[model samples]
Target: RWRIGYAPESWDACLNWARARKIPEALLETAGLVVRTDDGRVYDRFRDRLMFSICDEQGRVVAFSGRILTADKEQAKYVNSPETPIFQKGKLLFALDKARRAIIEAKFAVVCEGQVDTIACHEAGLEHVVAPQGTALTEHHARILKRYADEVVLMFDADTAGQNAAMRSAEPLLAAGLVIRVATLPGEHDPDSFLKANGVEPLQEIITAAPGFFTFYLERLTKLHDARTDRGKLQIAQQIVEWIAKVPHAVLRASQLQQTAMKLGVPESALQQELRQYRQRDRTVATPAETTAPAEDPGHPAETLLLQLMLTDERVVPLVQQQLAADWLSTGTAAELMRKVLRLHAAAAWNGHTSLLGADASDEAHRLVTRLLEEKRPAPERIPAAAGDCLAALKRAALERQFQAIKLRLAQPGLSGNEVTALQQQILDLRRNLDHIPRLSVWRSAKP
Candidate 1:
């Protein structure tokens, strides 16, 4: 159970208690339980407030969230504990210590937006509920949840901000390989108030019948952007495609793309062809002269070899789609042609270079496709191994480029302390990821 309690109105009350126990003032400052004045005097941080002790997974108290006990409009409503050696807001969820076994038993975790909502859900007999501690969802939080359950159901408040939070939560959760579902309570009712009004049965029924996160996200997206106009539809497809890219599974990505095309009333071929990669403006199609920057080696000859293999077997199309990320190949002739091939394959409309040349695709793409089809290819049995090597090289190059981009950001001016820490963490993750990728043994002799 959570250690819920109250603090006295006297500022000196906690100081006196700590002094009697011989607890050092510096320790209290480190624990974020007291504030030191400019003149070096100290006082209790939480006075006349209800304190909710935030704990780690093993049930050790690390920090507190103090709710103001007064109705004074001038005073801030909540005071949160700062990050310390023992506590990180991004890494700890509010009630996870009490709900881990419940989550494992249920095979899913319910993530609410606040501690009160989590406590109310538990009291209502839904024991698998937890919450982020005064922060947004982070990848660290996602890793912790993935330990107990394979699926996560987000129940945020029914407001624009809540809907946006659910949208933001999708990237981390999906990247962690956990299935995502969402339960949107009617009107302004959060889990706590909804349970209080309609009782447990009705609330449970709503949560049980909640839709998958993709469906929920698409609905909200349509509402936020105009779905009827051409420009609006393009924006919507781009956003949805970006979300689908975060999904780690290839079959799931294909299925979601089909759904996106169907829902947006665009042809599958068009969706695949026109879906610009995520954050396009931030990245340049790498060129040889920009060698000093974080640019992909666009001239790598593996691009042509992969093209020939794809022309050799239709199976290579999906393999490329499954393994190589979008925007990895420089947006040059061979790469663009390769994308066209993938688009045709996914649409089940792949006839040959003839069909590609006839469609509204670029003539350069058509010429490259035709040229690749004319070249001799590796044996059918050997195609997978060859394609895997090429894909590995492509993926490695992409990761290296990404790694350098974050490093570049670390060198920028005027970044806050938190931003610098986040960039450093991303660099570490990228390095770990790069180490796991198989080496590009085939491209060992290729030039820059």
Candidate 2:
């Protein structure tokens, strides 16, 4: 697990490696591993650097992050692989492959600002650590953490920029159902430096004693604004209202509103009035029609429901495989998704919802998966009935398609006598099959 690999530190060796491996110039350019000059010559993009392999949750290296071993005034200290098939900076959290299980065990995850900070945390025996790729945390990153963590402890640098990053990331993490705490390091030090100077005990104390988001927000906001004046108090109250809106739960939002009002020394009713006005204005900007959820497409429910069952319980896969054909999922995105899930299942690579996230899936697929996850799932006791309903629905859909196809063939001009008889027989058979597939009840109302 601790094995190390090396990359060439010079352009010559890199170029030679590419040549020997028969790598095409276009591929190199597309991967952002090579640069093309005006004269049409291609050269290695990285040289004379220490390399770090950035991997996904499956421990497969999808990209590289390079640190310049020797400082150069003219060049950046670090370089990263460009967005390719397997690399998307916003979606990746460094060391997740190693940190996720630890995070689950700990029930909390510590997010550092960079790779070095993450490595330092791991070395300090804090294995529940991950880092954004030299960028602010993204919603995808937050969702990934929320899969295993109830809380995220933000341990970015103890500086203005770090505070700003924490504020920016809090909304997304909170939206993903994570409670956030900000670990205030002593003085102006990142996790790596603090760990080096004071050792792990002090760092642990800071993390253990870290304040929740509301307390940290109040403290930081008071320090940033002149909270003593009436105008300043009003401004602070407005800011608090804006942040409280980001809390998705109505109960939590109401509690936050009361807390904010108490902190701002304003009556809770006044803050409630302000929030009401805010909602009224927001509604005015977006009409009811515009804000309404889109109408569900009735065509793909069977396929979608079936895929949901497969994902929730892999044990049901054989039942599905025995009962349904691939063509049953033929009408929409479900077809491709079922294939992908089955492939992952066959290889024992499924990790629940985590398996569906990453560069391997398209944006549409990610959106679909997100939608599926957000939908209210059946209770454990109802799974068998749900699976049966989905299976029956798929069979009905498949038979309908077969009947429609046979009907179309029979309607074709100048069909031979044998062809007409064969088509009619197939339609009759499809009708008989469709009739046998028991009617679907409201999935929740179905029996075992």
Task: Compare the candidates by TM-score and give the number of the best one.
Answer: 2
Q: How does each model score on TM-score?
A: 0.65, 0.68
Give the per-residue lDDT digits (tens) of candidate 2, residues 397-431.
76686678778777789999988975775566566
lDDT of 1 by residue, 323-355 (tens): 554535764567756766765564456775565
Worst 10 contiguous positions by lDDT, candidate 1? 274-283
lDDT of 1: 0.79
lDDT of each: 0.79, 0.76
Model 2 CA lDDT for position 201: 95
Supply candidate 2's per-residue lDDT for 428: 61
Residue-pair clashes per candidate, as listed? 0, 0
